[model samples]
Target: MNLNAIKYCLRQGVVSLFRNFWLAVVTAGMIAVSLAILGGFLLVALNVGQILYNIAGNVEISVFLRDDADQELIRTRLDGLDGVREHTFIPREQGLTDFGYALGDSALFAGLAGENNPLPDMFRVRVGESDMVEALAEKMRAFPGVEFVDYGEELVARLLGVTRWLNAFFLAISFLLAASAVFLIVTIIRLSVMARQEEIGVMKYLGASNFFIRAPFFLEGMAMGWAGALSAAVALGAAYHRLAFSLQREALLFFLQPVTDPEKLWPVFAGLLALGTVMGGLGSLVSVRRFVRA
Candidate 1:
C-alpha cells in the first residue's frame, strides 16, 4: 500500500521471477496457450458473422410468370416499373437445368429436358427503393402475367436471426475460457508462494513487513502470466499464418481468420501483458498474507 511496500513487492517480484524461473515459465506458457486459443477463435467467429451479414445486406425479389402469360408483355411491364433496379429472366428450361445441377447432377429431372420444362419462368429483380419492394412484389403477384412474387422474404431474415444469437453464444464462451485460465494462473501462483513457505516465515521472523515479503512473488506471477500469453499468441499466430499461406487464400477467412493480420498482434500482446500483471499481483498477495498476519 505504501511506497516502501510497493517498492519491496516490485523488487521481490523481479527476484521471484528469476528465483522461480522454471515454474513461472511453465505457468505462463500454459496461460498463454489457453488464452490464445480462446481469443483467436472468438475474434474469428465474430468477424466471420460480420461478413455473412454484410454479403446478404442488399435485398432482392423474384417474380414467377404465369403459364399462359405473354413473356414479352411481362418483361416490358417490369422494365417500366419505377422501383426495379435490375432484372434477370430465367426461362423454364434454364430453371430445370439449374435444379438438376443443384441435385448433384441427378438424372431425375432429365425427363424435363425430354419434352416440356415444368419449372416456372422467373425474374430475379433488385429494387432501388427498398421500402417499395414489398409493394412492387405484391403488384407483380397480382398482375395477370405473374404467378407469384418472392423476395426470399423469410430465408434471409432467418439466417440473420440465427447468426445474431450464435455470435452472442460464442462471445460468452470465449469470456468464460479466458476467465478460467486467469483464475487457474492465479491459483498456481498461490501454490508457488506456499511452496516457499519456510523462506517467507524466516523473513517475517527477521522483522520483514507484509509488503516487504510479498512483492517479488507477486511480480513473478504477473510476469509468468504475461510470458504465457505472449508465447501462446506467437505460437497461434505462426500456426494460423502458415496455414493461411499454404491453404485457403480466400474461403477460410469467411468464418475465422485467426492470426492472418499482423496488425492484430498488438492487441494480443497487450492482453497478454495485462493477464500477466494481474496474475503477479494476486500471487504476491497470497504469499504475503499469512506471513504478515503471523
Candidate 2:
C-alpha cells in the first residue's frame, strides 16, 4: 500500500517473471491469440455493417406516373412530402435509353423503338432518412399518378437481420474468449503463487498481513495484462489489414474502401489493447485474493 510496499511488489513481480519466462510467454501467447480472434470478428462485423448501410443508402422509392396523370400535380405531391429530400423525374424516353444502356449495345434498341416507349416514366425519390424509405414508398403506393412503387425494402430488411445475427454471434464468441483469457491468467498467477508458497509462508510467520502477501502477485497480473494486450493490439492490427486486402479480391465484397486503409484501424487496436489489459489485471487480482486470505 505504501511506496516501499509498491516498489517491493513491482520488484517481486519482475523477478518472478524472469524466473518463469517460458511459462509467462506461453500465457501471453494464449491471451494474444484469443484477443486476435475477437479482434478479427469485430473488424469483419464493422465492415459488414458499413456495407449494409451503403446498400440501404441506395434504396429509393420509384414512383411510376401514369400516362394520364398531371405532371405538375405529381411534382406538387412530391414537394409536399416531409420525408422526401429530392426526386428525379425519369421520362419514358429516358427510361428507354437507360434500358438500352443496360442491354449492352448502344444503337440496337434505337432503331426498333420509335413511336411508343414501353418503359414507364417514374420519379426516383430519395428519402431524407433511410428508415423512412419503406413508409414513404408505402404511402406513395396509394397516391394518385403512381402506377407502381419500387424499393428493395425486403432485401434491406433481410440484410439487416443477417447483420444483427452476425453481431450477436460475434458477441457470444467474444464473451467465451474473454472468459478463457481470464481463466488462463488466473491459473498462471495461481501456479506462480503456489510455486513460491514457502516464501509467502515465511513472510506471514514474520508478521506479514494478507495484503502484504497478495500485493506482489496482483501487480504481476497487471504487468502480464499490459504485455498481453499490447501484443494483441499489434497482431490484430496487422491481421485486419491483411485480411481486408485478401477479401477485397472477391468481387462481391462490400466496403472495399475501408478495408484498404490500415491507418483507420486505430480504434480497434486501442480497444483490444485496453480490453486485454483490463481482463488480465482483474483476473490476476481475483486469483491472488484467495491465496492471500489463506
| C-alpha RMSD for every candidate | 8.8, 4.7
Clash pairs, model 2 backbone: none
Q: 62-122, model 1: which lDDT tens digit per residue?
A: 7888788888887888898887888889888887887888988857788777457777888
Would you give me the overall lDDT of model 2? 0.80
Superposed Cα deviation of residue 241, candidate 2 (Å): 3.4
**What is the Cα-based TM-score of model 2?**
0.73
lDDT of 2 by residue, 20-88 (tens): 888889888889888888888878777776776677777788898888877788888889888898888
* TM-score versus the correct structure, for each prediction: 0.56, 0.73
| lDDT (0 to 1) per candidate | 0.69, 0.80
Query: Which regions of candidate 2 deviate over 4 angstroms?
Result: 63-149, 202-211, 243-258, 262-264
